[model samples]
Target: MSKKFLDDAYNLNSSQETQDLYQDWAASYDDEVAENGYATPRRVAAALWAHLPEPQTPILDYGCGTGLSGLALHETGFRALDGMDPTPKMLEGAQAKGVYRNLKGFDIDDPAPLQNGAYSVIAAIGVIGTGAAPPETFDLLMKALPKSGILAFSFNDHTLDDPAFTSRLTDWVDTGAARILFRESGPHLPRQNLNSDVILLEKA
Candidate 1:
């Protein structure tokens, strides 16, 4: 009944810390998050589906931990899915789900880990939060996309409260780099009373 990792997930200070934490938590990550009623993955999947209904669109689930997000996308009818995570242990869990067409592990510090225009759609659900990916990660994800590509991501209440996180999003839209296609605030983890904003952005 230990919830150490979940409790400290949002307080991570560095990429190393985040990686180390997930390496250990990967095995129980799904069950632990489920107990809290994790909802961002489904919410993000449905929002992306609304904008791009094509079942064959290629999708990159960045920071896809344990394949829950991949499952949601698959259930929503996306046939092509590629998952990438910095933590190999988590990637192993994701691989076991048999949802993704391709899966790989990359160093979180790599300046441009994603291939440009490789995926028409990218998802970063439950990433880019207080103790997860930093604000700059948003720019990296967006830059990897081709013009007209879509990026669907979420910012939990903790991330929303910090302008550093919210500002990165505004900077993109304000600069005409990307346009907000869909944004809705809803449950992230119901049991934790947490809420998150699921957003879809298309490169201009």
Candidate 2:
């Protein structure tokens, strides 16, 4: 990725201005992404659910823009869905779907608001790069789960090959903090000029 992308990705929590930018973008996000066919959220959600612990697992859809992942999760038989995002407009879009039990403004860098051991699965689809949360946030979220808690998330396809992020992810898997359940590379969305690698990480 370019330096700008990495900077935006790693510096998501650096200020309030960036947060506002996302809020502004949320309103037209669906229309903007529609051009790309919105393939990522569905693909990632499906891969994640396939490796989940159980059907009734309570899932936290981290950065769940417009409830895309939440809707997909529900269709896959996941119940007890909750959504969190920094943008109220984004949450508004998600709330309209009525699939989430709870929706709140969440800063991924500060996950203290989320209860510890309260989720069996956490999915942060399209929430790990450029103008989003950093990769370390995944570690924090996973730590919130109990042993054997399932974590299914995706990184932009471009980031999957980045050395810094890849190394960190590999470390987690190599150390047994998490196990790789599934990984797939495919078009996430064509309009957003994005692709992603959906990876399911299960906490051990």
- Please report the candidate that would top TM-score against the real structure: 1
Name every residue pair that clashes in candidate 1.
Answer: none
Q: Write the per-residue lDDT of candidate 1 for residues 1-204, one digit (tens) a residue.
A: 665477799888899999999999998999999999999999999998888899989899999989999999999989899999999999999999999999999998888888798887999999888989989999899999999989999999999999988998999899998999999999999999999999999999
Q: How much is 184 displaced in model 2, in angstroms?
A: 1.1
Off by over 4 Å in 1: none
RMSD of 1: 0.9
| Worst lDDT 10-window in candidate 1 | 1-10
lDDT of 2 by residue, 1-204 (tens): 211122233345464756765676667676656655777778876786666636667788988877888988888777788998877888899999889999988663464757889887788887775456655776677888888887777778566756656776788899988888888888876655667888887788
**Can you give the TM-score per candidate against the true fold?**
0.97, 0.85
Model 1 local distance difference test score = 0.92
lDDT of 1 at 100: 94
